[model samples]
Target: MTETLARLNATYTEHVIEDFQKKRVPVEIPLCLKEDRIAYGHNLEISYPLKEVLDVSYRYEPGKIGFLYIHTIQGVRTFQINSDPAGFVEQFHQLDHL
Candidate 1:
């Protein structure tokens, strides 16, 4: 997760999100099959920090509706309140267990 956050921070640090927030509307988590960690929807929100990192931890895998978490950057943050449930295989086909 630290590596992932660093990659995001490098490309989308504080300044980037500040510009984005100003130009666009805020929305819930953007569903994406974007990375090995996220392809299964097991990973969650991307943090965009402006100056400081508050904390980082895995609250859950984020495969349920109303599941929410905070991503921070300095003084700014975006809440991703997801409202989607995992599909049968769509959610677990990749699992090494089961």
Candidate 2:
């Protein structure tokens, strides 16, 4: 069963797979957390399963935008959103442990 937990603004960075194998492509897309997968991108949607998420990392700087890194099957995908990293981590942990 898939359920959307949150939708946030994301920045595609590092080793995220994109159609046509674009490099350093920057685009603002809606990132959604679902029960089964995380959905991202605009025209080219990328979905990563929750079970494939090997690690979750967060960085918060006073004057800079916060980042959330999700290490999944496709590699590390980054995000810059207004939501709290701690809250996201908490939710992720709960869902992972379930």
TM-score of each: 0.24, 0.65
- Could you give candidate 2's per-residue lDDT for residues 1-98 as a string of tens digits? 56777666766555556786856656577777777777777832788778898777788775677888888777897788555567556667667622
Residue-pair clashes per candidate:
5, 0
lDDT of 1 by residue, 1-98 (tens): 32221111101112234645744443323433222332112244542332233332222244642332233343433333333323321332333321
Q: Please list all clashing residue pairs in model 1, or write none if there are none.
A: 49-73, 50-73, 51-74, 52-74, 65-83
**Best by the lDDT measure:** 2
RMSD of each: 11.7, 5.9
| Segments in model 2 whose C-alpha atoms lie over 4 Å from true places | 12-26
